[model samples]
Target: MAHPERDTDSAAGTGGDPGSWPARQAPGARDLAGLDARICRCRACPRLVEWREEAARTKRRAFADWDYWARPVPGFGPPDAAMAIVGLAPAAHGANRTGRMFTGDRSGDFLYAALYAVGLASQPTATHRGDGLELRGVRITAPVHCAPPANRPTPGERDTCRPWLARELTLLRPTLRSVVVLGAFGWQAVLPALAAAGWRVPRPRPVFAHGARTTLRAADGGAPLGLFGCYHVSQQNTFTGRLTPDMLAEVLRGAAEAAGLPVAHAD
Candidate 1:
């Protein structure tokens, strides 16, 4: 189903300039909705722009009948979320097709099921943008918004996309008190963004591990933020038993509690 919230048609256009739109517009966004709109309209990275459009044009056979979102997948969840879940990037046949982060893919299946088990999600499935799935006290976003070729975004692309994540962190700073990063890539990518968003990262950056935890002090003497690391929900981890349902649920429950949200005990 085509997401009514996305402008897939006009998404291909550069909106007056290709490589300079994000830095020029991201900071000026006063609200999450405005930031999301600007994010979806960005065409700052030529390589990512071409790859996402190609995937949309010659889509997977299973979704040939479906219209791919083909644009930058915006962060999903309420603006006042107390916790944020950071991931690597959008999956090509997943969010790149369904227009919602972590939707239409097995990775999403694992992540959402864990969230539901921990009492943080409204549903255990997320197949599309309109699937009635909602996250409580948490938001999901990525370092790179567009789907990259071969599931690996170059270092240049990652740096170019930093402004969007930095701006998102700024918007969520009011209520965000905890973060769960789902891989080393997202961990490294998010630390700098967190510092840029007004949190003072420790001098020696914390290392990434399945159960690593760190505390960041707010630069302006506001509330402290807890950062947790977990294995990515990619098939490589879940299928190999490197990350299990029980394990994921435990981490999410811990993070939710750290954010001051009431978490139900998993059965």
Candidate 2:
């Protein structure tokens, strides 16, 4: 069955400049809406499909009345965004339930608030899709679309999901100038994906750390893409003060500056 948000012909993901990308380069050949439609319908990984379906069927106690969005969650935000936020994956009860990235989760709670504070998101709370939460200069995506067991995906799963992110990044290349990576996992995942999508990642690879920043050039000699790292907005981090709200805001502010966005920060 087709998803409600699935407008396959909308084609928002393929608007970026082609530059020197070969005409036959297949990574980002399809438009975003088309890719989104394809993503939501995927059942390629049997384990993931089983897990996500089970999560949707066996509702969390707090969300017993909710109808879960058991499908893959696609990237969120406008196609021309200058900055992107790369996360680990969906939360079984959060995005897996709400059909939107970062919606209805504490991690999202920390993230959206920071984006809102920095003038990227129009509002802080991302409870569900069509909740009027809008992002101007930023978009968010994850390597794995489905929520995994204990929030950890296996190496095989990560590699299986790599092409989707690579294609998405290629499509976003024209306007995307910076990427704010959450956690070391996201940092590691995005580097190779961008490299595969024709971005020239630095040799020896840049190290990942809280507030670490690096740049990767396009293989076709286009503009560089800045990368800024932040601690994951997981409850484990926020509850322990390893990643405070102010700390998140600081990283986003720096990312916006790096992406050439015009947003002022009072933090």
The TM-score values for the models, in the order shown, are: 0.94, 0.89
The C-alpha stretches of model 1 lying farther than 4 A from their native spots are 1-17
TM-score winner among the candidates?
1
Clashes of 2: 1
What's the TM for model 1?
0.94
lDDT of 1 by residue, 120-159 (tens): 9999999998789989999999999999999999888888
- Which residue pairs of candidate 2 clash? 13-32
Reference-based lDDT, residue 245, model 1: 93
Instruction: Give me the displacement of residue 94 in model 1, in angstroms.
Output: 0.3
In candidate 2 the C-alpha lDDT for residue 263 amounts to 78
Pairs with backbone N, CA or C atoms under 3 Å apart (clashes), candidate 1: none
RMSD of each: 3.2, 6.0
